[model samples]
Target: MTDRPTDLSSPPTPQPVRRSLLSARKFALMASVVAGLGAGLYGFSPAPDHFNVLSTAAHAQVNNEVRKVAQPVGFADIVERVKPWVISVKVNINEKVAKNDDSAEDSPFQPGSPMERFFRRFGGPDGMPPGLRGGRGGRGAVTGQGSGFFISDDGYAVTNNHVVDGADKVEVTTDDGRTFKAKVIGTDPRTDLALIKVEGGNNFPFAKLAEGKPRIGDWVLAVGNPFGLGGTVTAGIVSASGRDIGNGPYDDFIQIDAPVNKGNSGGPAFDTAGEVMGVNTAIYSPSGGSVGIAFSIPASTVKTVVAQLKDKGSVSRGWIGVQIQPVTQEIADSLGLKKADGALVAEPQADGPAAKAGIQSGDVITGVNDQPVKDARELARTIGGFAPGNSVKLTVIHKGQDKVVNLTLGQLPNTIEAKADVDRGDRGDATRGSDIPRLGLTLAPAGSVAGAGKDGVVVTEVDPKSPAAERGFKEGDVILEVAGKSVASPSEVREVLAAAKTENKNSVLIRVRSGGSSRFVAVPLAKG
Candidate 1:
């Protein structure tokens, strides 16, 4: 029938069962061959030792020198050890008084500024919740919470200065949920540290400060009262050290990545060893919450400030009595210094210790007591570290000459104003402006100008496009000194400029006095 007309389109189906049996037989043969090979390899391989699973022969092909790393478990042990020492501090502050009182200085940050937000004192009146703030015209006393830890057995504890500042009543609740009335022993506003004495306890659990500085990347545990939640714990690492956040002159804060929030101020950041690494004081936040950037006063600073606060009710720091600025490369080049370092004396205060010890405005303080002065801030911190009336040997670079001046530091006053400002009176018809060669300045004698004092030449006009203007010279700026020499007339400045050019100097250093302060400017000497 298939050959009759051809169902030629359909192929023949033949021996399906036989083909299947052949394929099964071939797969079975391949399986047997693989099994035989595996058995042979197993017979040649050495048997694993039951007693010594990690023997040398077992790992002969592996690199034994590779270190096996494991993840850290958790900070639970550290938290358990240090949690007993943490306390929640409650302060009753009159919001109306805190807003108007001079106690605002107790806070390093302003009340309503962005820095206030960045470094907001958690227990301060502004840091409290809106509901907790005074309800009726903001005139009632409001309560706020902060964090603190006991430092001694006799109920002596450490908290933030802002926490106890202007407090009508101070109280602390321990980890055990017991509240005690505490009194502020002392407070240091400069460092924002405070010492308080908790009543009704003689033997309390305490925490020890870490002996050395916490290294960056070291695991840290922050224990505190965050958002009124007592004994809250967060984990992170030490982000940095010696950070200056413009808090104050002595702003050597340890930056941490711990999630510290409001009410965490005055808390303790502990190391893995359960020792206090720093006291959490401020946080850098844009939305008024922790963004993983928090600042703490290092244990070193806390030790020093707390010691002083414990001794007396106030803190006194050493002051050199000089207005200083960082030494820039331009200033170094103009002054023939090989390296730009140390602090430049912008102006030594009148009758100040630095002025009395022969320190001049043009001098550069290179070192203090044999230690290098890193910058203006370092010099301030170094001097402040010493007690008042302490003798200090200052290495100074005065007018290109290196000299050591021995001076006793004075007590930093509660209120130390910055450098005095120059009184630039009404720019009446000053003397006709005179031009200096290669300098874009129209100068006039200070005595000829009505409001300008008779100490230096006054800048009648500055070419907006000139090097002088670019160097921060303003029309009313008084040129106090040119090339280390005081100038009273335009001719004196010209003479100094000519002399500097003759000496093949690329720039001339001039001390300029502006509205309220004096600073040195290095003006480039354009070639004729």
Candidate 2:
């Protein structure tokens, strides 16, 4: 190749240096970074707008988690803070002998000799389980251990109804180790709350109910006895709220992941602020241990029940006598609702509140006194809080437009009562119909089912393995009608089924309200 340096002398001009085509890319990236910083600084949202954004924290980018931090209450401090008021409940109930009488088996308590056996037979517990007590020999004390806390300094404490049900003698043990005789003043089974008073207590440690919306992922604590281990404390966040565990009508449970178990019933669920937001009551456990599905009854529910118990020594529900169901997406769509929203009025009592206000079946209630009804539980809680003759404005989803109806909520007859009053319907079987009847059924009132307003038939029982049982009939499932016949009680379902038996039918058209949604199902009827 010929040397070009020879021409360099003549040209004496510098050649232009080559540059990368990607140089613009670097500048663009820097510009983007700067613009991002500027936008963020100037209040431009940095979040990706999303539906689920409500559930996550925005500071997660920096690994900063959203924590529920209360006003720094210590475990013993909280125990010392709320303990003298915290109480232990002891319940006693004669274990019912199954109707299909079976001979008492060989039990440890059986007399060792004929004389002992005779003595045992003489003093056998009247209502006692096998082996626990000498048969008819002595009165048995069914010891049930659970939790509670005082709301007032005058010795008023609150616990779950399950804690006090069938209690012959309730002895409340305080943190100070003083056990006093406690008696249930009033119990609202709908809310699973009971008001109890202990003798010889004053200036007791008490906790005030916290009032606010619970934040998901907020640091919270549960204090109670677990497995009979007293003064146990567990921490977690709010997993959910207003959760209906099919427990009762007033089922606005504050769902948390805190470890609560068999003996932790009726403990307080405290926020970081040391305020009682809920009462620890339940867990979704498949193995009798904490499975991160613990639930608490919210303080709002507590407040209502407490006021009722204090004023009347019983809960007096404001009844707008009307039957209603949850407005499911399907029913909402049928009614032209944008979302499966509000409570659908299925039936109304002739002289109940809704009927007096001229409310009718098919009116979807969206709110009570401006409180929006998101589900049947919301409606039930709302109605439950009202006293008889207390007028409330109920928003109805009628046809399409939201209509406001002024109804003076009235007190319903105590014919139907809190599940605690049911005397035989508070346990797990209270949730299924078959538990009540052989088809594996149990029964509850329609209004009691979702706590939604109702004036129609309540389907409370369906037998397991029965044609109705196999088709998913549950205890809380409110039977609206059977084969076009209106039903209002478990007795009605029995009557309708009995009548259907006479007819040659393989299936019966059953209209029921489940999870607030009303639907018709062709339940298999017993073959004639």
Candidate 3:
């Protein structure tokens, strides 16, 4: 379209420009350039608040993505699915039975302490339930309560062995408020696991043990009866795995940060999939309350122990019959080993499987069935996993040579008695053995000491400031061997020490017998 501009009056009204000073396209372009320049200056300025505004938006986007994958909304659904399998275990013991049961005093508090009395008042001395501390002329029943869960549909349940260890009557209360009489089928004190059969029920809700071990930081739910309060549920993450808390030989426990109290023993710790990851057994609490650090027997251990308890009324563990110790770094160096990994044989039991198979003192057990043992504890656990009479190959470092020995496993006895004092035969002159000046020991023939055996030299005296004393040598300790050689007198010990020194050995390994037990000690040699 063409614009018509015609004016002749009043100087043509300044001739009202026939065209605008700038075209519409040029005006829009110039406005955009000015706006962009202002924005660039605002962004490049040293303003923390402005930068934080942009940073917060970026962080918000990242957090939204992370929350969608890593975090769970809640554990309610998992808890609901697993709670039905949890139950409360109650035991009634005759006063006579409770008195004879040593496990009845298995309290978290020290024996005879005031805290023990206080905790025992509510629960029994075992931290389960009520019991009679002392009463006159009456044999009243001592009642205890704990927690457990069904493991099969035929009313078979699992509980802590200590719960019904010597019970006269056992009762279980389910989540649905129904009570059933239960009989203890078998108990394993080593793992502290027990199997029981509930009467009056053929179909019971049971827990499925997790096929896979729970990983650290995985979410877990602990359900149990705490202080007679049944069906309590707590949520937390798996804090750690394969923990050894000095409970027993098999102390591989799964630690969780869930709040588990005294009465929660034997209850299952469930994973997000509603599978039992472990059984809540103990708490590391000083006040007998849930301090958020609790221990659970792994489901793998429970399954193994419960299976045996169900098949047989007693659990039998394979034993090699040897007193063992850790292969410390010093011991490793003394034995010419590259790594401090294995079990050092302190002494093999007389006529036992290991001794019968020619295993000797100071041998290091490095592996079983080609599986490397991490330490002395691992050796004990590996051997115990097998049944009695099972033959296996043991990789032993015997006399600085690696050899495999095949030995039949023996059954672990219920009570491992201390060996009797050896009848050492005749006496020798006390002055026959010379003093070991380097070790700061005054030696005498073991036969010279009135009650000491004749196998080695006796420590007549030990200088407190000497290397021997520092290595735990004391009077009455018999030195059985020095540098892998049997030492019968002080001269024999001196010869071995001289040989080790000439060989430039850093330390000499000595097997000593003290308090009816034997152990190997690596003593550092004095430098010239």
Candidate 4:
């Protein structure tokens, strides 16, 4: 604000004091007023009008600033509507204990006791001392509690998987203080989402999933059982979208700067219209309290996961059997991609869905089922959400050409087990003889080398001017396996070649291990 001068230059001209102070005549006016009063008009100001004008201008400026701020919207109404459905989940975990009893042999609980025989024969009193019980000694249970909220009017509440994990009993308290026993529906550990049914009784007000969902910058309210303190509400904006905090493979969390505490998880974050926008999941704080950095699982994601869990007792996501890595700027430049984007196919597992679909290494997966894949991790999570046998449309860019491939997805292998030979840098359990000979060295048998290290056996020496030498063979070329047999000794290679020669073999499949990596190669046998 501009400083007000003592003179009346800007003051109203009608005031006699303003007229004098503006011209430096106020001093004379004050003396004249004192003389006219005779007793001295002591506290009166001759320049009150000048001060009044400045005061009026300041009031107008303050009112104009007030008009700039839009009226505040209160969350009290939202809390009142949704609080009754948001419950404090108390999980009592009773971990099973192992017990051992140690007592005197004379006691009935002990073996070979006369009292035990008597009780067995004629229902006699136990020989154990009064108030002494026989039971195992070294075990106990630990208990923990957290919160959750109803996702449906039917009392289907969602909470963190950890809250109810290993829980013996789970009880929920409504905002109005009514308690109910809840039964677990299902839990997805990868997503940390748990579904529980409260056996919901009577009419309950459940928050609806937000329409159009929550966008960044939208106002939101976090209602939860904070600090186990029952029904606390805090407010913030949607700070970010799609954050991966490394909690799990499917960690697309919506970040918010709201007040959340220890027990606040499993609660609902309501958008401005009092609709459920997300489930409060985690907070980032060194002190473990509200530092305004919290995250929530988007309601859209939870809705799909929860419904699947309810229908199947577990969620089965699509799995395209291919491991992936993020595309770096270096990799992008090497691939001649203008911008660094899309997931890089690191290693395509053999016999997996991706390989069956002809998805090979060096191909970039741009989209999955028509959805743009942002990163390798997100793509993994997306594919993992589908059932193993569900077919998918994959959009891939190979050699600068975008193509959509339709693949018949197969059931994911329970676990991928792969092979190698020791005859030459190989891995396996069997061996054979080779009739088509290039190197003058004769084949020999190698004992099975199973459960071997990454490094396989190497050829002690190679003949000059031979096909083996032409193919870059040398001394110390470790033989992992030949024809899928684990060869431990050099003689095993002869056994393997001998068998291959019986079929007039043209090629020998060998697994060679060198430099800490195992690779399978088909070595063509040359005519002797």
Candidate 5:
């Protein structure tokens, strides 16, 4: 009776929540329909080509460009062109051996002896008898093999000097198995290049030397008779230029990676264009086989040396009588130079061209005929490039002053003895001095030290960290001259140092003698 009044005035009764449940089959069917719709949507969706078209197009363009500028896929064409010019050189060397006074039966080390067998078992190939081991001794002809290339149409070929040097007879075999007797036209040992001619052939296939320098990384083909394997071809790229392997005084060489081996020496290294870029000469290998590091005589050097060999039987280089050393930064500082460059004259021969031109020790050769000399080796090469009797203007710095001196170069002697005459001056009274902390040196008269002569001041003590020590000055070194002025006492050295300071110079050039040898050293002045 009160429900109508309570609902109107207070609260109403709560209603029950309603729940709907489906059958398992119907739920599975509904899930399957939803998945099918998702699959169809995904399958019918357009590909991402609209967004990736630019990148794909860019990649395709790059590939097309690469196809146009790629390197040669094969060197077959180059090999075919250059193989005909390559030849195998066989040489017969007639080496004379001194007759042994002892008979084979009397000798303990002769072939078939007990010592020979012992050595053969223990020493490997080196222990075998000279005769049995194919060594060059006794009264028989020794055979050698090398490679070369025809340089001219008349069968003029180029090869290493060592290959045909002192050969009793020389033979050349072409790629087609044609062999001919070759006459050695000339050989230059300095350059290790030789010229030989085959009189029987005319209009023969030949290779042309490239006029331009081969750039590093340029593809190269090495065609030669490696290990007596005729017409063998190997390819690589130029590894470096202007390499020096100390083969000789003129050691400028082109380095390549063309798999050169024993018989490959004296063969031509051709560019991809089939032009001779260099002549293979040496290989750097620890196992006596190819390690990919090889050296070649540059085409420019070959051209010059070959032309000279053909014209004259020898190579003549200009010589100036001076023993030179590189101008180090310390030496340059001591000489008051702006930079450490050029060659420093360590000694001038008494009657040599440099001495005749008044060039003396402690002079820095800065230039030859206005061309800058980089170092001692460059100076040697520049001078050697000139012919004897040619007059060259040398720009030299002496006592911190640049001077031009003209001198006629003399022919280089076959044997040059670079000996410097030490100036053993008269002995003087002993003198003492306290340590000069700036130079980190303690000095005394040379005569004060027992066996030290009196021509200069002896360095008694040297601070290991001083500028003097940094410039290679050491105790027992005798300072013969300071700033080109001879000093016989510590007082003289002090006087020269004071004078250099007065002149506001940063360094002082000193001539030092140690171990019976003398050299010029530039020592920097300690800052105040």
Candidate 6:
């Protein structure tokens, strides 16, 4: 035991410990080499051929080509050329003065006068005290600014009708700081266009109208005075064409994605070639600022309206007097039409061109001068493009027969008389109809219902989900005719329905009268 204690101070077994340390170092070195080899392979190896390498390269090249084609290089040259012809239109409106004898006791604004309401709504002008308004006699000058462009070398300019309307004095300022008094040559409110001329200048710089319409996605340059900042230039592409903003009957507007503001109205929207493609008229903005949605009058419409305004100081549009509605799919099916196209003639005026040309109610106008009309609005615009007293041919479908009619157009009237309301007397007694239930309608003689006349069959009850109800038939509606035949009793409706079924028809046209107006409704024979 003593000998073993003595040996504890010496170093123990060096050979076995050194061999174990060497084995641990060798394991770590081998692991580092394997990791380095794996990283090198991952970083330096080529992509496999089966991984669609060729297709990926092809897609990259195509995308690069598309980027090159779509991106515009510069618009400075176009802006510089078109900016000279653009002008700023300033108008001074002289408001009528109300007579006020007493300045201290009487307020200049009456209790319910427009000026009083205006002050209440928007405060006094320039933040002036309301009491001081009485001494001014309610007379004030309103200043308005807009944009326009020269159309002729003799200083004829084109702008919007709303720009200089009711203006006492109009002044136009060019890009070169020259200002001149301008006079209105003419205005067309229907098209929202105006023509004006400057007297003191000749050989002035002018812009040319584009020969063709700009296609969708074509680059456009809009130069205008936005928010009174003169000669502001913006660039965008044509977003759409033939847009209707419900402004007027001739509402074919070219929609663009340009940053247009309040003072940009009546400015010119130029094409890449520096030609005037459209006249900027309105913007579809929610915050009273540009949201990249703007509308312009197309060059085609501008050209025609300008020519008329220059010639006669007014625009005279052709009129074929007929009340029209859209041809629905149900209507087309009832009339045996292959597609739902054209305008349905709801009514022809008594002595108008349509009546003289033998056009009748329920006829569909399919074409004008052999050009296919897409809808009622298209037919209206097409006819309006022609001059009054021009002879035109109309292709119409009457009683399921296609016919051509020649008509000499008349001048469109400035005012159209509203349809008079039919006076309905009290109904007498109740008369019940047979319980057929196929059309899901309960009918009776018009005389049976209160305030229903004796001319047509009255709809007494209608199922909520029925075909007749789906076609907009109500409980008080009176069926005036079925398939152009007058129906005085419920039996006539059944007769027409039975005849349509025999002819393998899916729907039938029924003329219904509700309140004071009458319209044609096609009811489907299918059940829900």
Clashing pairs in 6: none
lDDT of 6 by residue, 68-161 (tens): 5556699887887889999988876555233433331222234544333332433322321111211232255445678999999999999877
Q: Quick one: best TM-score, which candidate? A: 1
Query: Which lDDT tens digits does candidate 5 get at residues 1-528?
Result: 132345476553322110111232344445556655766988853345632544455445555544544544788777877899999988776642334432321212435433344334432233321111123434544566789999999999999876776777889999999999999999876667899998687888999999999999999898888777788999899999887665455777889998887678799999988999998876665555677888888898888888877888777889998878888887887776899999988778789999999998899999999999988888988898889999999999987899999999999886534434333342233335567777888888877775676688888778999988887887677888888888988778888999999898888888888766677877778778
Better of 1 and 6 by TM-score: 1
Poorly placed runs, candidate 3 (over 4 Å): 1-72, 96-140, 419-437
User: Over the full model, what C-alpha lDDT does candidate 1 score relative to the true structure?
Assistant: 0.80
Clashes of 2: 41
Q: Model 3 clash pairs?
A: 124-129
Candidate 6 global lDDT? 0.77
Instruction: Give the TM-scores of the predictions, in the order they appear.
Output: 0.78, 0.59, 0.77, 0.60, 0.68, 0.72
- Model 2 residue 119 CA deviation in Å: 37
Number of clashing residue pairs, candidate 6: 0
- List, residue by residue over 1-528, the lDDT tens digit for candidate 1: 132464667764335533544454455556556655776988753245521333333233122212111233777777888899999998886653446554543343446543454345433444442112222224555566789999999999999886777787898999999999999999987887899999988899999999999899998899988878778999999999999887677888999998988788899999999999999887766566778888889998889889988898778899888878888898899888999999999899899999999999989999988989888888888899999999999999987899999999999998645545445556665648578747799988888777677789888888888998777787778989998899998888888988998999999888988876788888889987
- lDDT by residue for model 2 (387-473), tens: 888888888866567778887778867664223222224443334432324234566555554443364444455555676566666
The candidate with the higher TM-score, 5 or 6, is 6
Which scores better on TM-score, 1 or 4?
1
Clashes of each: 1, 41, 1, 61, 0, 0
- List candidate 4 stretches off by more than 4 Å: 1-71, 96-139, 211-213, 399-401, 410-528
Which lDDT values do the candidates have, in the order given?
0.80, 0.64, 0.80, 0.64, 0.76, 0.77
2 or 3: which has the higher TM-score?
Answer: 3
**Model 3, 47-126: lDDT tens per residue?**
44654554455455545554554565887777778888999998776654345454544442345443344345434334
